[model samples]
Target: MARIKETFDSRAWFMLECDDPDCERRFDDGQWYAYEDDLLADAKDDGWQILYRDEHPELERDMQYCPAHRLPECSTCTNIMADPAGWKDGQCPECIKEEIPNERS
Candidate 1:
């Protein structure tokens, strides 16, 4: 976590620290296991931002990095209404926890 911490609504917010977007592994010998790792990696690359907290000469040593605010759900889950009777689009911890297990390619 960064010193200047803030919360936002985005699916990425639910991600745990150890989760990786570029991991390669096999599961049940079924479909290729890539969606999760890929999504995470892409999000990190696309969302991360670099900033300098100091002025002039001190800028380089006082750099900070953070992620861009993203929607609470991925493109597919963003449309919570898609499953009106099933999942509710809360974007909170509860909602995120439930959705975490269902991410797939």
Candidate 2:
């Protein structure tokens, strides 16, 4: 697949593909992922691996499972607020600390 590199509203974006060979979903917008914070970092921490293009570091993007592949629930809280790519050991950091934000804004 071609590397994705684009900007919208002054924000830079890279392309993301699903790891599942059967579900090679691609996403250019970060919002669709619905990460708790720091999309890349959070995704990585949650066990999602990123694919890097050394030749195009600016376009280095991570591989993530689409919502259809994500598990719903905070492993620790047993709450349906966990993001498969943003949780660790089946638990979310926010839920572990009991500090999940109330709103996105």
Candidate 3:
């Protein structure tokens, strides 16, 4: 196939692009999948980076990423870092010392 329904978790469906220059596959598994937070967590676990892209405003899917890349943004505070070292364990330094926000938020 052309398309198949897949999920990072069994719940929500998250689309991820293959960052490999030769690959660059855009995943469009459809929205029937649920539990996006789980997918986000799974992406972090897999060392994927979430990058902001408006290339497809017509599709309304601005946030996209490559599984091979990792942006140093705090998943909790949503603050992006100039230095990738600023993030630790999927969080900013301050967030590492603080509690994780609601997963569903």
Candidate 4:
């Protein structure tokens, strides 16, 4: 099946699928799914299907590794860059460290 609702974390540069009810209405399941392809395999083993893999076309333009976002926490951080120049792009060294909304101008 096609994805239900997907969103850009707006910084980390991955497409988040909002399909699973277990993911706290966000992509929480995928958040901890980093590099653990085994988890994905296990899901398949357990009879779960991968309906779709959501991703940003823009990010693939540079062929970078698109990681899952922290979701509801670190998605909008200005610092989720793949390059050392990430800081220059308004992102912090770690994308999880964004300024609070009220703290910003």
Which candidate number maximizes lDDT? 3
| Model 3: residue 82 alpha-carbon error in angstroms | 9.0
> Against the unseen true structure, what C-alpha lDDT does each candidate score?
0.34, 0.50, 0.52, 0.34
lDDT: worst 10-residue window of model 1: 24-33
TM-score of each: 0.16, 0.30, 0.32, 0.22
Better of 1 and 4 by TM-score: 4
Candidate 2: clashing residue pairs, number? 1
Q: What's model 1's overall lDDT? A: 0.34
Best by TM-score: 3
Q: Write the per-residue lDDT of candidate 2 for residues 12-80, one digit (tens) a residue.
A: 555555655587655444444333245566555655544444532544343345555653555455554
Tell me how many clashing residue pairs each candidate has: 5, 1, 3, 3
Worst 10 residues of 3 by lDDT: 53-62
Candidate order, TM-score descending: 3, 2, 4, 1
Where in model 3 is the C-alpha error above 4 Å?
A: 1-12, 18-32, 52-62, 71-105
Taking the tens digit of each residue's C-alpha lDDT, what string does model 1 give over 1-105? 222222454333223231124323212223222344553344356553323233324343422222432223433444312122333334434445566543343
Give the TM-score comparing model 4 with the true structure, all chains together. Answer: 0.22
lDDT of 4 by residue, 45-68 (tens): 544434322332324232211123
